[model samples]
Target: MHVTELLKDWPCTVTGGRPRVQVTGVTERAANVGEGFLFVARKGKRQDGASYIEEAIQKGAVAIVVDRPSLSELPLNVPIITVPDCRKFLSYASARLAGNPSERLTVVAVTGTNGKTTVTHFIGQLLQGLGIRCAVIGTIGIFIEGRRMEYDCPEMTTLPAEYLHPLLAYCESRGVTHVILEASSIGLANSRLAHCEIDVGLLLNIGQDHYEEHGGREAYIAAKGRLLHQAHAIIVNQDDTQCRQMADASERPTLYFGAAAMLGYSTDLILQKLAIPGHYNRLNAIAAASALIALGYTVDDVADQISMLALPEGRLQRLEQDGVQVFIDYAHTPDALEAVLQTLSTICYGKLITVFGCGGERDKGKRAEMGELAVRYSSLVFITTDNPRNEDPVRIVRDIKEGFGGDCSTVEAVLDRKDAIRQAIFRAAPGDIVLIAGKGHEKYQQTATGVLPFSDVAEAEWALSEKTYEGKVEGGSR
Candidate 1:
């Protein structure tokens, strides 16, 4: 695409030579610039992309889009496009450069504090079951036509437009008719999903998270509200007052889904039979079902699909051996941990054991709340590390210990995650349930040194196998 054509609908002032340059790519990172590429120099929170303009030009960026006026001072002969908000413009320009593939496909975005991944997965599976080729973009990774793509970036739940638009174009080329994406609050606040045309927007639920990033709870909720503006039709969880407010704010058609909706409508009873454990999943099913229904599917058409839907990996994933059941979940927040533990407490036959910790440099306030919730719901608690990046792991544990309201006998602090899992499994008796919280589906543990390979499920399984092997050896010897 020519430089002029890329900026056709974009609101920007063009300076320098108006060369008819054919742009081959778009990127914010100067290192990724190649021949005939457009380098976007936008100011970020910590660093400014404008600082890398010279490097991008050296690496063959044909044109530049910059937000800062001073950046145009460089005596580069290439065309410089100046915009008020380069990050916002990047989304539109990227979509235009990628042929606006989202315009050709039905896109559904799921947003909330929790259940975004699971709900998006559910919608994708339902669309696939109905013979529609679909793609999913969210925390787990990108999925196109029932296959997981190699694109994995844990830093952000939603991909930036520079990457997201190209991925959508690729999906379109593969004949994907539908796409489901997780719309995260931070991503929306950063205008990541600005240009994508959303057919249906689903808000699962909202809670205390990313508080530091958004400044406060109100700002966080406002960021999530951006999804409603971009979407054509909105589906919200009525149980949550904030979600209800979001639904009210939508000028487009809206639908509501929750336990109350399920009870009020007889046909929605299929939500109760979801194969995934927990009432939260039932609500997610309703949200997914509501989205499909808005897309013109009936309850009967998708009821069976909902009943047979598989839970997303690491979402209350269960492993049972020798009468001890272990559940691995991505419950890092206070609300998420409480929900998972509360559900397990009711079904657990013996004791409910929880192993969890908070991530470093995140919302530290939630650490103590999670600790308190763990102790309130679990028979035994093991507070361990969960990606203590840069910060001292011991300090993070101490912050969590404050929530315990003085040391309790049931709560034990274990710094080593492997030992924590091992102790939890080895000490479990028959009919006990062990809940491994935080760092679900993540195969690595981030520390000050670097990312180290770690898997909660793998560690738990190894511990169980070791215990079983030890028991067999002792019995044979006796």
Candidate 2:
């Protein structure tokens, strides 16, 4: 494509000469620049891309797109296309350059503070059960035509415009009929999903999260509502007050899914017979079922798939060891923590031992709330470190303890996560339920320094194994 063709709607001027520049590719990162590529100089949190323009040109970039009109430092020969927001233009230019592959497949985007991953997984599973070929992009990673690709990308949380065509192209090659994605508030705010056509959008529930990045609850809700406006049909949780408002704002055809309505398809989205247990999960299930139904599946088809659906790995997953029940959930947010703890409270006739921690560098406001919920519900609360990235575990523990109102006999601080889990297991007796909250199926613990390989399921299994092995050895001696 010629430089003139790509700069449509973008303010550009050929300063030195009107040389016909034919660029083969486009990139926001200077490192990715190759022969005939157009490098976009974007201002990011870490560094400014304008600083790397010399390097990009050295690598044979034919054109450059930037927020500024002219730079004294930059070469006058290269065409500069100035835009008010380069990030917004990045999505459009990248999509056009990549051949607009998203138009070829039915794309369903799911966004919320919680249940986005679970709902996406459930939707993919339900579609698979209905014999439809579908692909999913979320916390678990991308699924293409039933095959799991192990590559991890931030695009899973926020669909980047750069990878949009590549993913759609991959799905197209694999014969995938539908694509399901978990769109985060950050992704929506940053214009990641701007160019992509969302066929259907599912809003699970809104909660106070990512306030630091989204500014406040209102801004976060507005960012999530962006998807609602773009979707052809919006499926929402009627039980959520914010969701009700979001549904009303959307011009698209809307469907309601919740446990409050026994008449809806979500009436039994979360059943007692499932491997995972939670009323909140029931809401997630119903939302997913309604999404599938809107995608053209019959009521029976939706129910069969949803009923047979199992919780993905560690999202509200449960295990039984020596008459003790252990529930592992990915509840990082305060709402998630409260929901999981409340569910365990109902199921555990004996006692609910909660082992939870807050992540560092995230929404710090939720720490105290999580602490309060843990104290209120659990028979025993263990406050521990959970990916305290760059933040002192002691300080994080103190913030959580603050929520306990100073006389916290029920809560104990343990900075080491593994030790916390160990102590929770040791403290629990027969018929007790141990709730391992946060870092559900994730294989690594993210710290401010680095990522330490970790998995809650693996740790729980090892603990269970050690106990069983000890029991067998004692029995053998007896």
Candidate 3:
């Protein structure tokens, strides 16, 4: 694409030279700049892109977009355009460079504290079942045509604007009709999804999370709300008290989904029976399915497809051993933990056992709260390590124990996650349900220095098989 045509709609003040350069690509990072690349010198949280102006120029950048006026003082001969807000302009610049593929595809973005990944996967599965070529970008990984690329990064839950154009380009080339993505609070705060035109924006329930990064809960929610502005339709969980406030701010057509008995009118797509289990999962499914139904899919069509929708791995997943049941869930927040416990208490006719721990260097306020909730729901509570990255495991356990009233008898602290799981299993008698929370689908366990390979689901399966087989042999002898 020609540089002149691309910058024609960009909100920039041309300082030096006309927009005559032809552009090959758009890049924000200096290292990615190459021949004919239009380098965007924008300020970021940790580092300023303008600092790398000399480097980008050396790497064969054709133009530079900056928000500051001093960019004109540079001795470089490359054309420089000054925009009032380079971060805001970057969205359009990237879209213009990629030929605006978002305009062609039906983009459905799901944002909230939790359930973003599950909803994205659910919507992707539903769309695929309906014979549409759909792609998913979220915590689990990017899924293109039902195949996913498993890459793990600490902040990989959300899609970044840099990967936006290239992935959309790939989808457009493959003739994909729909794309579902998880838009995280941090992702929106950083202008990651600003460029993509959303067809339907679904906001699941919000809660306290990322306080360390967001500074507070309000800032985190405000970030998630940004997606609603660019959406064609907005869907939210009406049961959430704050959700009504978020919905009121939307100017587009809106709909609400929840399990509320008196919601003015019946839900367009009610979750009569959810195979995934948990009240929270049902709510997430209802909201996602309602969004699809509102997008023109029939209620019956969505309901039919949802029956076969398997729960995303490591989310309240169940295992049976010698009449004991174990559930593995990714409940890392207080609200999420509460929801999981309440759901388990409903179906669990026997004693409930919970094994959980908080990640180190995260929201420390939630540690005691998690412990309190775990003690409230389970007969036996085993506190253990969960990604204690660069933090002492013993200290993390001490904080968790604070919620248990210092009764070491009621709550046992096992720093080793494998030993924690085993102790919970051994303590469970027949008709007991053991819940392994925190690390659900994650494969690696992060310690103080490095990450050790581990899988919650795999370990649970192995333990269950061994216990069940041993029980069978003992029964035969009896």
Q: Pick the candidate with the highest lDDT.
A: 1
Candidate 2, run of 10 with poorest lDDT: 469-478
Can you list the residue pairs that collide in candidate 1?
A: none
lDDT of each: 0.86, 0.80, 0.81
Candidate 2 runs further than 4 Å off? 9-19, 70-73, 261-276, 468-478
For candidate 2, the per-residue lDDT at 272 reads 40
Error of 1 at 357 (Å): 0.2
**Residue pairs in candidate 2 whose N, alpha carbon or C atoms collide under 3 angstroms:** 389-448, 390-448
Return whichever of 2 and 3 wins on TM-score: 2
Clashes per prediction? 0, 2, 0
RMSD in angstroms between candidate 2 and the native structure over all alpha carbons: 3.2
- Candidate 1 has an lDDT of 0.86
Order of quality (lDDT): 1, 3, 2
| Candidate achieving the largest TM-score | 1
> Cα RMSD to native, each candidate?
2.6, 3.2, 3.9
* lDDT for predicted candidate 2 compared with the true structure: 0.80
lDDT per residue (tens digit) for residues 186-301 in model 1? 89998889999999998888898889889988899999999988899888887899888877877987777787673235445676557777888888877888888889887877
Residue pairs of candidate 3 with colliding backbone atoms:
none
Candidate 1: regions farther than 4 A off: 152-155, 262-264, 468-471, 474-478
How big is the positional error of residue 117 in model 1, measured in Å on the Cα after superposition? 0.8
Between candidates 1 and 2, the one scoring higher on TM-score is 1
Query: How much does candidate 1 score in TM-score?
Result: 0.95
